[model samples]
Target chain A: MKVAVIQFPGSNCDQDALYSLREDIGVAAEYVWHDSTSLVGFNAVFVPGGFTYGDYLRCGAMAATAPVMDEVRRFAREGRPVVGVCNGFQILCESHILPGALMQNVNQKFLGQDCYLKAINRTSPWTERVEGVVRIPIAHMEGRYVADAETLARLEGDGLVAFRYVSPTGELSEEWNPNGATNAIAGIVNDKGNVLGMMPHPERATRKLLGCDDGLAIMSAFRLLPVN
Target chain B: MVTVRVFVNLKPSLLDSAGRTVTGALHKLQFDEVADARIGKTITLQMEKFDEERVKAMCAKLLANPVIEDYSYEVLN
Candidate 1:
């Protein structure tokens, strides 16, 4: 199976994403430029985290308007797998491929630390291998996920709640929340479950050098999808 | 000419932690009268004619996120 990692002008994690997927996970992944229109043959797409367009105006606001987002939308509609990390997540939300907008952190400060995440729904192919609670590293100044009441209810009702934050002990309670969001939501899937967006940088936690083991479990979720 | 104004905000279900913190700070400063606080954005664009669908598409495509935020544009002529 081929995995395509999108490379925007300012994407800093392309190498790391590529390294983790090809070297660590032993997957055949290629880098796709942000201006490309076609996304054929690739089974999955990864919008890695970084400051796209110098983060001018808003975080992902500029990148969302990029020329290639049209294909991103089409791929999402075709029930293909897409994951957005950090600023990538912002772009996806900006493109309306996922639910909710990521707002500034509650403290208005850039947070760079390891945190825990609970797999709220494992039904999706993206979460099938990850069970219970795991840890991932989150690094961003704007990572708060926000949505309206009715829309939030719809997401929950549709089993779109993918991953939430909790204590390292795996206690699925509100007290374990590291970030500021309802029920400490760290990640969520779109209505179709083909798109996954999360604040935590799984690419950052893939190696022991990064000081976390949570990323392995998260990436393993991709293996459940038949490699083609 | 038509002027379109777009309003964007976080959904009610999504927590406005930043707004909450600001409200908390205000309360700490003895501003208890502040019932609630929320943060959002607004933009205005001038166009030749008003098309609700096109305007909605613009908002959906760039101005605002339909998933986390709902936006409505007022047409002024």
Candidate 2:
């Protein structure tokens, strides 16, 4: 099955995603421009991270309305894996494919550093094989996640949460909550479990030579699913 | 001609991080009278006629994120 790496005007992580999916996961992948309106032969889609539309109106707001998002929406509806990372996560939320919104960091500073994550929704295809804490780097000015009380409750109750920031030993604390995301969430899946949105850069950590490969399991999960 | 102005801001329950930072700077400047600060944005749209329904749709669809933000608009002709 081919993986379609969706690329927006300002997307910078498209190459990395393509490389990881090809070299690391051993899959067929190619770039799909934002103006494109189809994902015909692709079984999985990846919305890479970057400052799409120069972050106009709001981060991910403009890109969310792009033509390619329509195709991504189609894929999500059919239960195909659609992974959105970092800025891609913002775009998916803006497109209403995912719940909640990402806001400015509580500290009001751009963060570029390694973050630890723990799988919260272990039964989904996105997190089923993920075990223990995973180290991934995050680079964003607006990464804090916000949702209403009822939504948060529903996500938690429904087991839609994918990952949460935590300490090395899997402990939650203020120090590890880099952006003050509610429940220290780092990632979450849609109700159908086909759309996954997260604030960390998993593509950057696919090789152990790059310092950490904990993200490989997460990023490679798309191939593990049968495209159902 | 009609001019529509949209104001968007985080909900009151959510923390305005940038506004808090600005408030800290103001306190450092000895502006103790400023009890608090909240930051928001204003977007203006130009249209041939004031269409309240269209403006509402725009606000709901793009200008503001209903999840964490609230929006208000005014029309001037």
Candidate 3:
């Protein structure tokens, strides 16, 4: 599968994402600048996490209006798969590509560690290859996901809830959540379930060097399912 | 004159971890009157020349994020 990882100014993790996907996962990946207008024939587009625009005007706010985001939105609407990790998730939220905005961590600290995630919608294209519950590393300060009651209800009812916080034993729990929340929702897919925005860095945890292989299952989703 | 009011907030489905932290802090401080606290920002900008379409463009393009934050403005001529 052809994968394109977007690189914007101040995007520090683009190489990490590219190396992991290309060398580690054996996926065809290229680093695309944020100014590009067309994604061309790429099968999947990966928005890597980083401090886009130095997180100056609200994390992903400035990066959302980038030239490439136009194409990103178009591809997303066309039912192509797009995966956003960390800051990429922030950009997606800012661009209105996905619901919910990432806020400051509940602990008010930059959290960098391996996190456990309970697979909420295993039937979706992003999680179809993953098992019941999985472990992945999440590294970010603005990782908390939030939304209103009506929208949250709609997302829950529509099966857009893709992953939730889980205990070490792989049991879902709201209290043990890294970020404070009622459902401990870690990640969510769009209404179409093709565009997925996740806080956890599956690319970071894709190899043993990163201390886990759980990301393989998540990244493998690209290979398992054809782009919708 | 035109006054634009922009309300910025976390989207309904995303998590507000910072909001929960502030609430917890209030409880720790023994503030019982506070039930829940969600942090948000409201900005009021006054323009000498009022153009609804231009103001809306500014709001949609720069002032607010339509996805996570909803913004509305009124013109006082």
Candidate 4:
């Protein structure tokens, strides 16, 4: 199935996502400009990471209102796969397509580093094949995730957490968290389990030549999404 | 025409990390009287007419993220 990689003006990771999807995963994926209002031919959508709209107003705020986001919202409504990475994640939250918000990192710095993550909810189609500590790079100024107490409880109770920061040994601890995200969360799935959002750049770590292949497992989930 | 000003701030329950950095900077500047610091932004709009309902809607829809922030606005007549 073909994938639609939504491209905003400031998106820098669209090419990386295309490369991983086409070269590594052997999926047909192409860029769809931000102003586009259609996703008819694509079965899945990917919102890649970048400082969209130069991060004006707030990270992802302007980009969330981009025309393509309406289609992204519609696509997600159709029970299809939608994965937003880094700034994409922020956009999703800003658009209310995802719960919670990505706040300034606890340290108030743009952190860029490889961090370990464990699949907290492997049942999701987005992370079902991903196992163990999946090392991926996170690059963002506002990557810390926060949600109200009621929403947090629902997420925890419903197994909506797709992944969580963890030590090499899969131990959850503050020391393993680089962004101070709530409950060490690295990624989360929508209630329908079709939409996934996370700050880590799985697209950047998808191949062996890139110095790591752990991201392949994550991509594989998107590639081999079940035909339900 | 009237002007409406909106203020947005992170919820008090959340850690204002940038605010904390400002506090640290202030401490280093010898402003020891500062207990804590919080940061927020203000936006002003010049409109043909001031509609409180529309302004609140704008705040909820775009000016602020209710998940992490709160917003209030005042009209300048």
Candidate 5:
């Protein structure tokens, strides 16, 4: 399977994602510049992390309106897998393809550490077959997930929540939440379950040398899924 | 020429950590009268035409995220 990893200005993790997907996960992946307007050949799209547009006007705000996003939105509408990590998550939220907004961390600090994430939804293409808790590193200043009460209720009722911050023992608790995300949400999928937005850097954890390879399961799930 | 000034802020239901931090500093400086603080951004745009509706659309579409923030604009010529 082929994947497209979008590269916006100030995106630092594009290579990491490409390496993880292409080299480690054994899928054909290429970098798609943000200015490009098409995503025709790729079956899957990955939005990697970084301070897109220098995090100006709000993180991922400007990058969300890039020319290529229109095509990304269309690609998502086709029911293909689209995963956004870190600032990519912010961009997805800014693009309104995903629900809610990421706010400044409740602690008002940038957190760069490994955290445990519970797989809340095992049916989505990104999380299917992934078992139990996974450890991933998150590096961001604004990763707090929030939405209005009604939207939050709908997300919960629909089982759209893809992941949640949890203790190592797999218990959900505010203390284990690094960013104070609502409901300890670490990631979520759209109503259709094709689009996923999460703050953690799964690509960075795809290799044993990186201290963990649990993230590889996520990428593998996307690679293994049949093209739509 | 027309200029539009837009103000965008997080909704009251959301916690404003930056604003709270600023309020804490203010209280420490003996500004105890400050009971609550909210932080927001003001974006100034220069335009050739002044249309209230267009400006509102601009704010709604790109200048502010409707999910967590509210926005207002003033047109000046």
Candidate 6:
């Protein structure tokens, strides 16, 4: 089960993802440059976090139009798992693989801290093994998730909400929402449940030396998915 | 040559923190008459042909995120 970690010009976390998948998760993984036009052999694609294209125009706007995205979209259509973290989430939204836009945090500040995320839906393979609330580190400026009311309702009705910010007691509240994301959403999956885009950096939390390894549950779940 | 000016703003339903901060600063400067302040972006594009449809497509596809923002454009020849 080989995974492909896409590397944009400004992607700073590609190596971290590669390490987490290759060393920590003991999975075969490789980096695919943004300009590459094909993604033929990989069973899964991981879009790691970073300031892609120096965040030109908008976060993930330019990177979303990269040559590799076309092939990424094709891979996604084949029912393969595609996970995006942080800026990766923005690219997914910009590419329309997921509904909603990640606007500037309501506080209008760059936030970097450990946040609690509740697994709202465990049906998807990505969250099947993740139980209840988990702590993950989030670092970003434009992570406030927003969508139209109809789309939001559809996402809720379809059970596409994968994770949401929650208090230490697992209750949802505005104060616990670091970015003021709508409904305290921290992550979401596509209608097919194969594509996942989330703000937290799971790769950064997979090692014990990093002070936490709670993120391994999600990665372990993803690693166990059947390859197509 | 035609110049297309695109205006993009966050939808009224969403809060604009940056715009609100700017409005607060303006109020402190005694611009008390300002009822409300909303911030948006304007992009000026130079095109060889005046193709309204193409410009609209550009705005829809890239200039603005339809999920959280609205966009309009004016063509100046």
Per-residue lDDT tens digits for candidate 5, residues B2-39, read 88889999888889999999999999999999998898
Docking class of 6: high
Task: List the per-model TM-score of the A chain.
Answer: 0.93, 0.98, 0.95, 0.97, 0.98, 0.98
- Candidate 5 residue-wise lDDT, A70-158, digit = tens: 99899888888899999999999999889899999999999999999988888887888668889999999999999999999999999
| Model 5 superposed RMSD (Cα) | 1.0
Query: Candidate 1's residue-wise lDDT over A37-80, tens digit each?
Result: 88788888889999998987567888887777888888799888
Q: Quote the lDDT for A200 in model 1.
A: 88
lDDT of 6 by residue, A80-127 (tens): 899999999999999988889898999899999999998887899888
Candidate 3, residue A130: how far the Cα is off, in Å: 1.7
Q: Which stretches of candidate 5 lie over 4 Å from their true place?
A: none
* lDDT for each residue of candidate 4 in A1-228, tens digit (9 for 90 to 100): 789999998999999999999999888899999999888888999999999999998899999899999999998888999999999999999989989999988987899899999998878887888878889999998999999999999999999999999998899999989989999988899989999999999999988888899998888876688643
> Model 2 segments beyond 4 Å from truth?
none
**Per-residue lDDT of model 2, residues A1-228, tens digit only:** 689999899999999999999998778899999999988888999999999999998899999999989999988888888999999999999999999999999888999999999999987787887899889999998999989999999999999989999998899987999999998989999998889999999889989888999888887786677853
List, in the given order, the native-contact fraction of each candidate: 0.69, 1.00, 0.50, 0.94, 0.94, 0.81
Clashing pairs in 6: none
State the weakest 10-residue window (summed lDDT) of model 5 chain B. Answer: B68-77
Question: Scored by CA lDDT, what does every candidate get?
Answer: 0.80, 0.91, 0.82, 0.91, 0.91, 0.90
Q: How do the candidates score on chain B by TM-score?
A: 0.83, 0.95, 0.66, 0.95, 0.93, 0.94
Give the Å shift of residue A138 in candidate 6.
0.4
Predicted candidate 3 versus true structure: per-residue lDDT over A1-228, tens digit per residue: 889899999888799889888887787889899999989978888999999988975889999989999999998898888999999998998888998777777778898887888788877778877776688888888877777677789889988888888998887676568866447888899988889998998888788876888888888777766654
Give me the candidate number with maximum DockQ: 2
Q: Can you list the residue pairs that collide in candidate 3? A: A145-B14, A145-B15, A146-B13, A146-B14, A146-B15, A147-B11, A147-B12, A147-B13, A147-B14, A148-B12
Tell me how far candidate 2 lies from the true structure as C-alpha RMSD in angstroms.
1.0
